[model samples]
Target: MKHLLTIFKYALLLALSGVLMWYAVRGQDLSTIGHYIRSANYFWLGITMFLSVLGYFSRAYRWKMQLTASHQTVSYWNVYHAMMVGYLANIVLPRMGEVIRCSVLRRTSGVPVEVSLGTVITERVIDVLVLALLLGVVLMLEFNKFWAFIESLFVDKYDSLAANRDVLLSVAGIAVLLAFVFGYLLLRNLDKLRENALFVKVIAFVKGLLAGVFSIRKMENKSLFLFHTGFTWLVYYLMDYLAFMCFPETYSLDMKAGLAVLTFGAFGMAAPVSGGIGVFHVLVQSTLLVYGISKEAGIAYALVVHGAQTMLVVLMGGISFIVSAIHSGKPAAQKQMSVSR
Candidate 1:
């Protein structure tokens, strides 16, 4: 029933977005939009594509580094493949990449999938810190008069879209906090929490998870982490901002707004919605509209931006899969990655 409801909700959302796209596009000449899309700066699209794909690989490298493996020297080849698989998975589900990527690495390297996955959490911790830091900077700098509407988008109670967003974010925060609390208490009182075999198993599972996350116990690999993390975020913006030229109206938006769009894009894509389909489009479109672009142009901007990004990840990841298979004889099932130390 729950799964059915989720499917139904997504169906509704997709339907809604389709309607909005139509209305926004009501009187607009799609031929003009097509011409705009065709006349788009292909060079920038190419650049965006390259950077986006490169960034995911960079993310893979960081994940490999976090493992602190004795056999793997953060093989770009392996990381690239796992990242691709993960990205492809996310195109279907919400945040499923962490586990799927872990599974891929575990199969290829004989690593404990759980442990590998834990390290992914560490990677995400770093990512979250960096993103939050960036968001803070962007908010502080752009928080003047220009930010009023966007801020109200968070504040306004009468606005359905605005209200839904804030509520969703709040709900997510609550759920995360609840999970953390449950885990902490369960761990602290394992004996009591283990009133049955299932309870004990759950406790054990959480312990294993905690262990995996802390897998890089004594490894001091800050340089690699900095390189990968910095590069991942840089590419994120490069992918988001540079793709602006793909549309007609946003052709002249400043670099700062591009960064702002990236910021907004992060939040938009953070939803649990499928592939972030409706979520991503709405956020990107709204952000552009916030900057005075028409809704029609905003939708166009969203499509071009996301489509370009998808193409980049899919193509690079597809290539990565082929290379890893043909070049690396490794079965992707080994538990211990051979570090090049």
Candidate 2:
């Protein structure tokens, strides 16, 4: 049943990605995209791929610090291996990468799978919050330019709501009244609620997660963690900004434009598609379009950026997996041989 569910989820995400890819390319001239890609500056692209590797290393180190804070002493190389394997898994399996990451760490370092997963979950939450904060900054900087674009998204929804305002109001009134009644009842029966087996189990699980989420507060080297986090984002922006210089058509775009693209592209990557394949293209192209770039140019840019990053992950991840297997397999084999003797 679990395997079937996983397969179904992947199929759904793959279908959604295909639809988005079609929407992005439906009207574009493929020849022009190819031309732009062929003419791209390999110099900048080389640098972009270099930065991509550094980003992975930085992230691995940051994760190590998080694990250390929880008293799980793992080697730097193991963490790096786990991180690479996770990226490789993501290219093939979308969000299953996090589970793969925890599994790798557990096998390599003897850390409990649940504890490793807790740290990973904490890292993901932190990353999302940081991305949100960065998005807010970008919006503030470009709010005036995007006001109409943003307003258009909501104007239709506002009109629909206004048309049915009376009915919505009645629903809201009933929801608030029911909330009050439930809240009162829950408070009155707090002791009974605590005694419920399912509730008790859920509470215990939540507390463990909360402890992991708050682990940063107890870290000995909080400053180092902060530095790594900030540095990772900085490298991320540089990765995006450098890709702009890869083609003459996009070279004219400034840092602010890169920031906007980075913000939206991050959202695309965060989507449930495998490695942000189609959604990243659409969101990056859309952001470029807002800056008056031609659709062909945007597609070319997206192809180079996403392709190079993906290649880097695949290359490093392949090497890491092989090396980890050799390093991990030898000891277990020796132990088994000794036991047989």
Write down the lDDT of every candidate, Cα atoms only. 0.70, 0.85
Candidate 1 residues 1-341, lDDT tens each? 99999778767766754655565566777876676666677788888877776776677777776666423344555666877877777766567866887667665555566667777787777767877887787778677734775566765565666658878899999999999999998789877666888877766767766766775664577776787778888888877777877665777888778887888778767666545666677777777776788766776777777777776666766675666555443654232354532
Q: Which regions of candidate 1 fall more than 4 Å away from where they truly are?
A: 1-31, 69-76, 158-201, 215-217, 246-248, 319-341
lDDT of 1 at 91: 64
**Cα miss at 327, model 2 (Å)?**
4.5
lDDT of 2 by residue, 76-125 (tens): 99989988998899988998898897777767776656667778888988
Q: Model 2 Cα displacement at 246 (Å)?
A: 0.9
What is the number of backbone collisions in each predicted candidate, taken in the order shown?
18, 0
TM-scores, each model vs. reference:
0.75, 0.84
Least accurate stretch of 10 residues (summed lDDT) in model 2?
326-335
